[model samples]
Target: MKAWEIQESFGISHLVQVERPDPTPGPYEVVVKMTAMSLNYRDLMMVTGRYNPRQPLPLVPLSDGVGEVISVGAEVTQVQPGDRVAGCFFEHWTCGKPSREALKSSQGGPADGMLMTHKIIHENGVVHVPAYLSDEEAATLPCAAVTAWNALFTEGNLRPGETVLCLGTGGVSVFAAQLALAVGARPIVTSSSDEKLTKLQALGISAGDCINYRNTPDWEESVLSLTDGVGVDHILEVGGAGTLEKSLACVRFGGNIYQIGILAGVTKDMSVIPILRNRVRVQGIYVGDRQSFDAMNAGIAQTKIQPVIDRVFDFEEAPEAFTHIEAAAHVGKICIRV
Candidate 1:
């Protein structure tokens, strides 16, 4: 088997594609023959040693991938050989409240992740991919999509006819838009690139729903104006501290704010007065548990939604994938065909 390993010296240049002995699954484990993998901002942080400088070296990178079950352990009964599936972002968190043990099982960080030719996964840690999505599309789901679903459906209790604000056109934001549309909720997307906003518009988002954050730095006003000054029912807060205050402004009184990323700056000086005065709710959304992933897949299967992929790189171009994500030029998901 071949895998991309993040060497001791971090950065994309240190990512080496190397050979490894084929893995044999333990009891209750399954062997996945990876067909496609997707990149995330966290992957870039890991590669650059920005998130955890002391993260163990020579680690397999990337947590999102869709593969076929090539073999299963004797006790594995959840999936059979040839079933297409994607690894759960958390190998141990099945459902409900997460614990330290469950959180520790997450890939692309504390644990070895996807991004290899053949990887071992716990039988319960992989789910059947939606039939509507191709391998490339399914490869984008394990982290970003699940996190979006957790923020909206699981935590926000989002309803149709409600307005939602998407912070950017990254993977999670795009997935939020897709899921919002699937449930008949309206999505307003913001992007610095007018071209990226156009991509969202092409996907059935209303012409007036796209906002160019670069042109209008105070874009929260645009969101409020769109809602007739009531503000949106929910805001997907992927921008972190840099935009948290703006998000607090854009959300309606008592509306939910799903904190999913820190793309803008990890730490910022901000007041909590708005949250207190408006009676707003802010929920931190991690990539969800297996139960959430299953529910999301069921909804996606029903809606027949296909995740938007900005580009796909060949397996050999893994290093370039990291570079591409670091550039932040893509409108949606960037995948690698394994």
Candidate 2:
């Protein structure tokens, strides 16, 4: 088997491809022949040593992948050999609320990830992919899509005809917009690039009037104007500290804010007055559990929601794919065909 491993706590440059022995499954585990994997901002942070202080060196660095089960261990019945399955980014949280133990069990961090020809995952962590989606599309589901589902449906409780706001055109935001539309909610997406906004509008995503945040600076005013002075029912806050205040300004009174990413930097300082006055509920979302992953797959199957894949790279070009994500050059999920 071939895999990319980080032998030191360095940047993406430290990722090296090497040959390794194929893994065998444990009593409750399954070995998957990886078909595809996707990139996320967290993958870059892991390589740069910016997230998860507990992450050890010599790690595999990806959380999203789809593969075919080639082997299964004893006592495994959830899935069988040759099933098309996608592993949860956080492998231990199968259902309900996440525990401290579940939080500690993550892929592409301290534990090995899916940047390999084969991966052995606990049987409990693997969920069957939607039959309608391709390997490239299913590869995008484990992290970005699941995070969006958790933000809008699980935590935000976003209802049909309600208005939702997404911060940018990145993978999570794009998935958030798509999920909102699937459930009949209106999506207001913001981006610094009007070109990308135009593309978003072409997708039948109403765009709810986009803001060129780079130009407007105080883009929340535009959001207010678009909502006719009422604010959005839910705001997917992916910019972290940089956009927290703006998110506070744009969410409706008694609305929910899903703070899910730190793309703009980690430390955040913002006023609590708006939260207090509006009675806003802010939930910090880690990528969701396996039950949510299964529910999301069902939703995708029902709605036939197509995941937006910006580009696909061959397995040998995995390093370049990581570089492209690091440079923020792609639109949606970037996948590696293994």
Candidate 3:
């Protein structure tokens, strides 16, 4: 087996491809021949020694992947050889609320990720990919897609005709927009670039629905105007402290704000009294549990939803993919085809 390991050092330049012995499955585990993987902003932080400075070195650094089962252990039953599946971001969070133990088992950092040609994982840690999606598309689901689904349907309980405000055109934002459309919710997307905003319009978002935050600095007010001053029903607030205030200002009373990222500035000061006075819900959404992933997959299959992939790099070019994502130029998910 061949894998990219963050050897003795902690930086993208230190990622090295090396040969390793193939993994043998435990009684309840399976071996998958990984076919594709996707990059996340966290992956960049992990490789650059920012996500967790003490994260042990020599780790594989990606959370999302799709693969084909090639072997199953004697007691494994949920999946079998030849089945197509995507790895769960949290291997142990099968259902309900996440536990401390489940967080320890999250892939890409504490666990050996599926950035290689082969991987061994518990049968309970994989979800069958939708038949309508290709490996590259399904590979984007484990982190971004599932997080968006959990933020909206699982927590937000998004309703048709209700409005969703997605902060930007990143992977989670794009997936949220697609999932909103799939569920009949209107999505108001904001991007720093008009070019990126226009690109979203090509993906079935009406020009009226895309807001250039650069042009409209008070984009939250634009969101309010778009919804006739009632404010959006939900806001996918990934920008953290830097944008949390505006998100709070744009939400309807009792609306939910799904806090999923710290891409903007983690240390910036922001007010919290609005969350109390407005009775707004600020749900902290980690990736998601396996049951929710299955539920989201079912909806995805029915809606024939296609993940918006900004670019697909060959497996050997995984490092380049990291650099591309670091540039923050992509409008959606950046993938590595194994």
What is the Å distance of residue 44 in model 1 from its true position?
Answer: 0.6
* Poorest stretch of ten by lDDT in candidate 2: 202-211
Error of 2 at 333 (Å): 0.8
| Cα-based lDDT for every prediction | 0.92, 0.89, 0.91
lDDT digits (tens) for residues 199-247 of candidate 1: 8888899979999999999999999999999999988999999999999
Q: Write the per-residue lDDT of candidate 3 for residues 83-121, one digit (tens) a residue.
A: 999999988889987779988888999887878999888
TM-scores, in order shown? 0.99, 0.97, 0.98
Each candidate's clash count: 0, 0, 0
- lDDT for predicted candidate 2 compared with the true structure: 0.89
lDDT of 2 by residue, 117-206 (tens): 999999999999999899999999999999999888888778899998988888999999888888889999888788878877876776
Best by lDDT: 1
Cα error of candidate 2 at position 257, Å: 0.5
Output the better candidate (1/2) by TM-score: 1
What's the ranking of the predictions by lDDT, best on top? 1, 3, 2
